[model samples]
Target: MSEIDRNQGLARQIAKNIQDSIMQGRLSAAQRLPSEVELAERFSVSQPTVREAMKILAAKKLIQSKRGPKGGVFVSPPSLDIAAQTLHETTNWLVSLGAVGLADIVGARRSLGRLSIAAACEHAEREDHKRIEAALLELDHTEISDEDFCRLEVEFHQAVAAACPNSLLRLVMVMVNEALIPAANMISFPFRQRDKVVAMQRQVFSAILVRDAAEAISAFDTLIDYQSGIYDIALEQRTLGSRLR
Candidate 1:
């Protein structure tokens, strides 16, 4: 192998060893890793190779570097936000590339939405209720722009997802939002449809607030159906327009 390739292989091996240590509980969160020189000596590699390994770990969010007197590379705690952001970006890319279609996104959202509504109905706290209410109030603004309206709609659903106690479900919900919401927003929302959409959302909120899982799920399904109908109409119109040209 070339010198550069050999060094890269060593760097990956070192990074894997550190990842295993972290996963196996040998290294706890916030525990400072050994200095680069110490790691280079222990692993029998150059300091640059060890630095490459550190970069890999940092990119994966497995480690972080601090500056100053108390500064060093430290194990990073598991972060839901980082994980969710990563998933969101990947999902958006798939959607943009047409590797994932609107129907696929809608189906996934339906499955996940049912679970989220059920969990939120059972576990929603006072604070979660407050968030949903705040989003609802903003959505109810009479003269809201379509962009703001769409954004608040996503925020409202996110608030509902937050009410669910399962962290994994919440993370997946963010991915679903990234995949579906922007695509739906590309289709214009008529002013007449806005009232119906908000009304359906209100039904969902009321059902969840009362801890009525069945009702909440039903309302959510209805909203999904309406949105799917809108998407279908838009697709048909585009097809007809293409044929006319």
Candidate 2:
């Protein structure tokens, strides 16, 4: 076997290696890692390299540090819920700035939505299926208000994106979902059509559950088309205002 290189960027390498171990659970949560000197010796690198690696891990939230003799680097765990919330809040800020609008939101949604649909079709497990179905259940309950229902719709999409097992896609959805919250809320869901809407949602979940990619995409298109009426209302308001002035 070849010896570890010390003259190179060993610190980054060490950081990534430890990060993988932490993410993979090879290092349990709150467990202290090896000392920098020990790792430097093991990797045949300088102590500074090991220290740099630890800093990288800290930046990524993969590890936390402490002081004194008892203190050391500790592993951090993955959290999808927290990740999703970050995505949502950041995306919302982008929208509020006019950095993106409804049309852009719709386009991005369609693309990401298709990707999730395809993945969900191929990889949806029992838990994923339950999550998709649960959204519909909450929508069905009479206590859900219009604003809350719209938020839930975005949450449903974001949740499905999370199940795609792709972190980047989930992050993108987080921003997109937050940015679209206003437009999402403006989409009028006629109370009489609630059942139909819920049924369409079920169909999307069903397609994913069965691994039917085409069906999933088609169902999403159908659902989105119904929701697009919200945009039409906006156009109508703009036109009426122009005539009045």
Candidate 3:
């Protein structure tokens, strides 16, 4: 490989090493990484190479630099929002590049959503149930535009996922929601159709409230199947439009 390629590969390797350390809990969140000079010495690499590796880590938001004299790279603290955004952007990129498709996203959401809903049914307290109900009520408002309604739809799902006892499962739900946003935006649900969607959500909520896992999963499956049909129509429309162009 060329020198530049070699440097790029080295930087990636260094970044992976740090990422593994973080994942293995050897590098705690918010902990300062060794200085560039120290890292270069330890890795037997040039300071510039170490800086390049640090840049890779920073771009991934794995490590951030501080300002002032005490400035240094530190592991990024755990952030659900940040993680969700990263997953959203990465998923979008893959979809745009045709590396992943709507069906793959739909399948993932269907599987993960069922798990989250089941867990929520088992673990959600009355207050958690209230939050889900509130979001659903907000979604039922007739005056909201399609855009506003779509936003509420996502929020309602997120609220349900929040009731899950497992944080990791909740994060997966967030990622799935983010991945599905593009598909959701492609189909414009009429006001009447939105009402039907709200009814489906209500069914899911009702099942969860009663701790009926089978009913909840079945309702969720029906909801996903309904949405997936919309996605299929949207994809077909896009294909036809491209052919016409």
Candidate 4:
């Protein structure tokens, strides 16, 4: 039993080492790793232990394995899309597990929105403004459905966040925006409500265009506060209905 535990520990360690190599660019994406026998020899572990380590790495999307005459494990490339998706899923899990509440999500969205706006004031370029303007224009269309408006609203926020120079900050905004989807889907905006939201979005965008970070932040807060109030009311009604039943 002790020997088995030691072997398991070794496999985990090996996985970490390999993970580090891939992350640090020592192992390039699509580059094949050594065979299991070679890895075992190099690590001074049994072949089964090396295989176990490979399995661990494979599960993390750090590597992929193939079986045949010309197949071996290769480094999996890093992807912002995948990372954003993982963050979205993890956030949902936290909410489901009661580790995070709706209030926490709102708070995070506001804070991150402020930070991104500040960064954007410093870093936004002509192209970024164009992208944001296009998204903003979509909100003004009168014939669009409530669902389409909601989706475009998300896209508009994403365009604003993308103006920030920091990739990590942009990624965080992506996660926050995606996390709001499940709740956003629950509340359909009436025509008046949609118009109000579009007005707020225009204020935020105009502030951003002028590089007024403070105004942009203020407008964003207003938008978030309004949306939060609506969501809170929906949540309360949901809870009340559930209890009555």
lDDT of each: 0.90, 0.73, 0.84, 0.84
Worst 10 residues of 4 by lDDT: 183-192
Error in Å for residue 54 of model 3: 1.8
Off by over 4 Å in 4: 1-17, 20-31, 40-55, 64-72, 142-147, 181-192
- Two-way lDDT contest, 2 vs 3, winner: 3
Number of the top candidate by TM-score? Answer: 1
Predicted candidate 2 versus true structure: per-residue lDDT over 148-169, tens digit per residue: 7777777677667767777777
Instruction: Please estimate how well model 4 matches the true structure, expressed as its whole-model Cα lDDT.
Output: 0.84
Q: What does candidate 4's lDDT look like per residue over 120-158, in tens digits?
A: 777889999998899989988989977787778878888
* Cα RMSD for candidates in order: 2.3, 8.7, 3.3, 4.1
- lDDT for residue 195 in candidate 4, whole number 0-100: 77
- Once all C-alphas are superposed, what RMSD does model 3 give against the true structure? 3.3
Error of 2 at 169 (Å): 2.1
* Candidate 3 per-residue C-alpha lDDT over 1-245 given as tens digits, one digit per residue, 9 for 90 to 100: 99888888887888889999999999999999999889888888888888899998888888988999988889999988788788878777777778877778778888888999999889999899989999998999889988788788888889899998887787778877756754455453531377778999999999999999999999999988887787777767778989999
Q: Which pairs of residues collide in model 4?
A: none
Best by lDDT: 1
Which scores higher on TM-score, 1 or 4?
A: 1
